[model samples]
Target: MTATPPHQHDVVIMGGGLAGLTLALQLKRRFADIDVVVLERRAHPVPHAAHKVGESSVEIGAHYFDTVLGLRPHMHGAQLRKFGFRFFFSEGRRDIDQVTEVGASRYLSVPSYQIDRGIFENYLGEEAARNGVRFVDSAMVRSLELAEDAHQPHRIEWSQEGKTHTVHARWLVDACGRAGMLKRKLGLAQANAHDCNAVWFRIGDRITIDDWSDDPAWRARCEPRARWLSTNHLVGAGYWVWLIPLASGSHSVGIVADPRLHPLDTMDTFDKAMQWFQTWQPRLYDELDGKRHLLQDFAFFRNFSYGCKQVFSGKRWALTGEAGLFLDPFYSPGSDFIAVGNTYITDLIAHDRAGHALEARAQLYDQIYHSFYESTLALYTDQYPLFGDPEVLPVKVIWDYTYYWGVLSQIFFQQRLTDMAVLGSLREELQDCQRLNFAVQDFLRAWSGVSRRRNRPVMLDQAALPWFAELNRSLNDRLDDEAFKARMRASAERLRALAMEILERARHDNPTLAAGELGTLLAEKPARLRSDAPSEAMLFEPG
Candidate 1:
């Protein structure tokens, strides 16, 4: 018998999860006739609410899904519109209504969703197939032979129905989530300083936080009474509990903790988690008490935050999603980064198709991607200790969201992620923002150490902050190069003003509080300085 030849495609994407499927759909959408194949290990229609962990979406991720991919109809129909992030400093307390609540009292201008992963990915697979993508579900990739040079095609061996098959492609992408077949084969795994663990599960019924309290005052705290729609966080000294609603009438719950404070062994299983919750979050325990039979799934990850040495390559191979790098899920940035990585990969593929040399482009994208990862890592690294301090965490959250919306979200919303000239022009402002963030994070930690961990009964409504709300609303504004550059400069100015306010407030409360690098970063720049600095009222006043 003669040996059979393998089928060939323009791009071969491994793993049929959210990342792989979305990449295929994006390539098809961009190139129209481009041949792409996605190999997925799991069968179609995985499950409903209990399938995956990443359920919440922020501004960037939400924009990517709702606008970039043109899935607004499906999202609006099948997913829950998020009511912004809600927080409660109700650790070890059953009275969640009395805790310091920090969140928007109403919806923001932009929207995000609480996704049902299984439903969404299944829909993505169907969409990919409709768009002429060769999606092979239940097909496990057995091995890969990545071409060393651009002229040759990379080869993939996969097994389905107990039969082996082979395929060839000009480009190869690994979106295999944590399996990271390509990452492992190429020795791309690395570690970071964030040492945290997580345990997550989905309950069969909705765990409505609004219904947990009946006080008219607490119920009326939010407009339209929709706190259940928000990605709610219950915070404590070293951990935060997430409550996200799913379209499937289930509620997703998770505990993310610094291993140093709350060890994994304390809540690795369902019984243990319930017991742990009873101790730390009695309100949640009460809600889940009789629903043990409704427990759908439970899973955990140790040291979840990781780094990849490389992702994009000149040799027509790349990695996206978890195969590349993951910072932290604190702000629901997983899908946001996926959208970003996939965009970069698609652009690289376009460059290759145009017969352009990819070495320089690939290296530049990798550098930019790594810069994003490192910058986001700063937000979570050594910051868990401050999660419980209601007084400080609200300030940190406000500042963090400002940085996200003011700088990075602008790049993505304005569709300038790949514009080298624009990025170069705004590099100094971006760097200034990053440095100011580093200093402020340090300052926050120090403030949390000395100040009173005030947990008041009032809501720190984000919408009340005029500039903050406008910064978010401005994400959809159209701007040319100069206007965009001006926006970046203004954003940097906003960050500087906010950093100064935080320093001044902290100093006023605790006169010994260190300003760290704010003295240099917040200093006036002759070329561009704002005369109208933000008022002290921008932040929540001390009661």
Candidate 2:
């Protein structure tokens, strides 16, 4: 008698968390007739707010979720709209209002959100199933047999309810996050130079920053008095504390620090974290002193930032999300990278469906994706020392956002991530911007070394900068080909000018400031420099 044949599908996604489920939804939307199955380890209806740590979204991730996936209604309805990133240099102080504050006075044109991962994932599961994706929760992937030939289908075996099942698929994806099912199996794991540790927890009650201060002027700095809505960062020498509001009425708090200055052993537990906070951040300690019982969860990770050797392959299998690579969470880039990886994988699968050559496309996409990773990695590596330097940090934040919005965000927003010709044309400009960023990060570190670490009382409002605000608003513009190219050229000039300005300011503060390539990079003038160069007012001035 012949045995029963395994079920067949076009795609089989392992570990149906954020990356896998979202990828499933994207594939179904991109190709309605494609057969896709997502195997998830955890059961459905997971608890909200306390489920995960990455609950923040920036521009690229927000656009991917809202516009790309058409989930704006759900996001707007369920998640809290972020006011923008707010930073306070209030280390070891109880009076946060007197600290040098850096943030927008109002919301930026481009929107982001404080996500409740559990809430969003549950919705995604339902949505994917509704759209014909076979989302099997509480299903554990037992084994995988990747096909060597492009013509053959990969086989996957999973167990659900103590019953084993097998399926064959043309494409396989490992979105298992840090579990890295395929990455481990293929020896694709790699470590990064950044050796920072992180500890995060969620409190059942809302911990509002707005209520921390009673001063009228401080409360009125942000329009509508919604500072609580922002992703607030409390920065110090080797660490930063984050306070993010969740839609489920819980507050997420975290401490991310370089182990050299702040060892993980110090704040690895609830009681220890409170003691550490008392010495480093007295105001936060005071708030949580009596509310220890409101704590819903606690977790920590050593050296959270990592790199994957290879995420995409011509062998019909790919890894997305934490299963692949992860950069720093300072800018909340976890979801942004997720969006990027998912897009690349979807494009590769599309190539396979069209009977096109997968080897070349896979190689090119891998290069471009890793290039992006390295570019972003420069922002965090060896930069924690400057977290407490109020003067330099405000300047660094402006430059960082400029680079993000001007270059990388443009490629993504214009749907040009996979456009080889456009990318080829802008390669020089992108490289210049990247080189400048490296120099700038080094430049900032050097600047901080000589910094006075000024803790002023003024609020450095980003929205007040007209050109800066305009650059952010440009994300919404749907530009034609010529317009997009022109925009990129303008962005290149904008970044060059900003870099020159930052270098000049650093030198102005300390004549012996050391920065490599900044002077030479700013010297080369292919395009005319903008007449409206960034001024000293862009930075926080010494009183």
Candidate 3:
């Protein structure tokens, strides 16, 4: 059955997820005269299940939504507040919880919010509607036809109630989440180099916390704190489970693992995943002993690519959010990246409408976005083994810098487009670091060799301290004033100096010193220096 064509609009956005909605809102705010229509396959008032995954929001993401998108009221109402992240790890007899306190912390320590995507998306949808975005629900877009000339308009053919319809617009946006609907239609199904997938479901009434304290004040403080029981059990092999709390008193529990270890076809899906959870994390299993019930079966996907090669091909179309770049959820970057993409795309669209050269601006945007995603992907994937290892001290240090970098980048640096350019250059250095594939096993072997003997010979002495201090001062002056950033950069410089000193001293003290050991020691420069330094100084030192 043929359906009538709707009136042409200035912009047509495909997919009604958070990314799509955000772009629509930004576009409306930027170009009020341009008509924007969003096509979503789901029905209005989308029925979203509780305890679905992705409940955590970083501080930067929240600020963008509240401040940039102008949705503070909606966010405040639906979002669950969170202080900076707390990482727990143990080394022999010592245990550490890395906590970044608000205000004193480098990143905006404003608590991030944990929100149910279902509830959050609904609110965003409504908010977009209020901003004059016309939503076409339960509308499945079949294909897109690009116009031959830049002046000609693009066309989208879609269906509803078994009938067909066509919509024309100057711009078409593909914000479809993971499905990559538009991307697939255009034959852009590039597999992510990293083979990772996740399976998640909601657990209701299966987990409960009870306070036994008799003191009223203690109980009052303990009860509320106890409610925040979201936990991540980091089992090795690129597998981890996340337990997040929702306002409905349910927990969002899921397992993210590499397909190589736990193939989807072999496991019983939910039952096997739950059984593994029960065996590995007994404490959580015990908590849910009498309280837990499964809400749904698991959902899985692999080849989660970092960025699309062609996010924006011309003035007529642009991709935003997951459609453009889908980074791993290891650090909860999904929402933040979406907000940033929307902001940039809309800003460019606004400029183009003002008779500016939007094509050139869009090309620049695509270049920066791709570079950012590639760098991020390389950074995480290369460090995958490091993060997977609970004992790697260097991993902890990198994470400390990462946490603060996210804060500083979002709050201060990301605001300036130029900063992103500088950041892009930094990523090039990181790419080189990743290509080395510094495995954990190699590091541990070297550490064992060095720390094994009790009477280990000192290669350098107090006499060399002057040179080290001088080198440190030189590097310190060049670093950003942030305590953490300066310390990290200085630490790197110290290692380089220490490596040279070690080789020079070894050559002078013992002419027969093995070249292999010197090479090994040199290779271990940065991490070795970081580990040997006093606990209070390095970024990764556990507090």
Give, for candidate 2, the lowest lDDT window spanning 10 residues: 532-541
Task: For model 2, state the Cα shift of residue 371 in Å.
Answer: 0.9
Best-fitting candidate, scored by lDDT: 1
* 1-543: candidate 2 lDDT, tens digit per residue: 011488889999998889999999999989999999999999998899999899889999999999999999999999999988999999999999899999999988999999999999999999999999999899988998999797889988888888888899899999998999998888888998999999999998888888888999998988866898899999998899999999999999999999999999999998899999999999999988888989999999999989998989988899999999988889999888889999999999999888888888898899989988998999999999899998899999999999999989999999998899988988888888888888888888888999988789889999988888988898999998888888888888888777877887888878887656777667775335655444434554555
Query: How far is 417's C-alpha from truth in model 3 (Å)?
Result: 3.1
TM-score of candidate 3 relative to the true fold:
0.72
Candidate 1 local lDDT, 423-501, one digit each (tens): 9988888887888888888889889999798789889999988888888999989999998998888888888778877
Error of 1 at 384 (Å): 0.6
lDDT of 2 at 239: 93
Ranking by lDDT: 1, 2, 3
- List CA RMSD, all candidates: 1.7, 1.8, 8.7
In candidate 2, list every pair of residues with a backbone clash. Answer: none
RMSD of 2: 1.8
Q: What ranking of all candidate models by TM-score puts the best one first?
A: 1, 2, 3
Q: What local lDDT score does residue 369 receive in model 2, on the 0 to 100 scale? A: 90
